[model samples]
Target: MRLITYRHDGRIGTGILQNDQVRPFVGEPAMTQVIEQGIGEVADQGIPLADIQLLAPLRPTSIRDFVAFEEHVEGVRRSIDGATGVPEAWYDAPAFYFTNPHAIYGPDDDVPFPAASVARDFELEVAAIAGPDRTIFGYTIFNDWSARDLQSREMTINLGPAKGKDFASSLGPWIVTADELSPYEKDGFLDLWCSASVNGTEVGRDLLSNMGWTFEAMLAHAARDSVVRPGDVLGSGTVGNGGCLAELWGRNGRQAPPPLTDGDVVTLTVEGIGSLTNRIISGPEHGPAVPARRRDPARARHERQH
Candidate 1:
């Protein structure tokens, strides 16, 4: 079943997505609540899916992004240093980051491209939202927006991607449950295809079958001692030759990074999960960052020790 987190009449809730209708799951707080409580009985009694304000499907405890696409990695590595091969460490284990859940946006929303972003681009990826508490429930489509020029410049300092990636990351209209898409495992392939359109013009497109590291492997590598709780998310890095700006405006292209202008509407579509349409509103004025409270220091310290 496709699960969704949404708000109706200013109240937020979770439900199952069936056809074009959203079946509401009463007594469930959010997707996070359901994941912590486990599935089965609650899912069986979900409400009908209809018109609802689809929020980010879950309140992720963490967002772990992995370098699952070798070509994308190789492409970046080569561009940076003329390196011919990927680093041994990059291949040894899965690498990820703890992203702000508050940074997440929903389908049909507007993305504020900060003025600091001179080169804005979109990355087509498959994002997995953990559902079974510490388990990878299933995969969904993701768009990792990037500021190519900013990222490239920061690499020289070797502290990388903080401001470059912290601004925005997009996820679904729904978090597809594993049982709904099990074929994604057996054949080690998914027919899911991805595409991006800016103001009705197609910019990025690729097949999900192109990933170098499978979802299972990425999960195993990410879960190695770290507990990926329900509502958490994992992104499958960009696909091959699918660099939004690297291939278009980086050294690979004839110009500098292609900067998105005001009023540009960028729509990302994945075959099964549906489309995420976001308009480019004037930065800051569009909306403030959803203020996330600072992490609790005592809890933070305990978590670190574990």
Candidate 2:
């Protein structure tokens, strides 16, 4: 079942998408609520998909983004280290970090390029919404928007991706339930292909099956010392080969492809999960400059920890 959360009748509504239309899941209230009830009984009335405005499937309860693709890691490392280098810890277990859930965007939303960035980029990823017993409730397209400059400069401090990534992350169009993907399943991997295009020009493509870590491993690791609750989300990180511009630039001898600019339309399509299309909107506004540094989000988080 393809589930959607959208605006209808002057208010937010939820429904199951079918045949280019939405069948409202009336008693469920929201996808998160319906998730709690279970995915077995999801049926409702109808509406044309073109009529309603959509939002992120649901504001996920919490989000954990895991780097699970070795090919992607090698691409990035080769760029930075001039040779491919996989971190030792990653070989032992899946690794991930928390991100701001508040910055999510729905399909068709216009993303204001985070002001502090010059090298604005996108990470192509797949995300799973949490369900009972650490299982996946469903999957959605995740565009992990990134500010390369800020991310690299901060990581040198040995801690942080704060301002670099916190600004915006997009997930949407709809969620494809796990059951719906069973036909495409193969030995714990989904036979799904993900590709991205910027302003109608194709930039990245990869198969979801190429991911090094499975959702089960990510969930198990995330829940090791804490609770993994309903409505939480976990990202598959970037897929193998070329999945982001940073990786692309890295692999291509640093000859940069055009970074996103105002009016650039970025569309990410996963053969089974559908697509999330967003436009980059430029604005004169910016957060405090990373160099100037008045307690930015990343720094603030660090200060509070001490």
**Which candidate leads the pack in lDDT?**
2
- Stretches off by above 4 angstroms in model 2 are 39-44, 80-83, 287-306
> Per-residue CA lDDT of candidate 1, range 136-165, in tens?
686677777776666777667876576667
Please, what are the lDDT tens digits per residue for candidate 2 over residues 32-53? 7777776545455578888889
Model 1: CA > 4 A from native: 40-50, 77-85, 184-186, 285-306
Give the best candidate by TM-score.
2
- Clash numbers, per candidate: 9, 0
What's each prediction's TM-score? 0.81, 0.90
For candidate 1, the per-residue lDDT at 267 reads 77
For model 1 the TM-score comes to 0.81
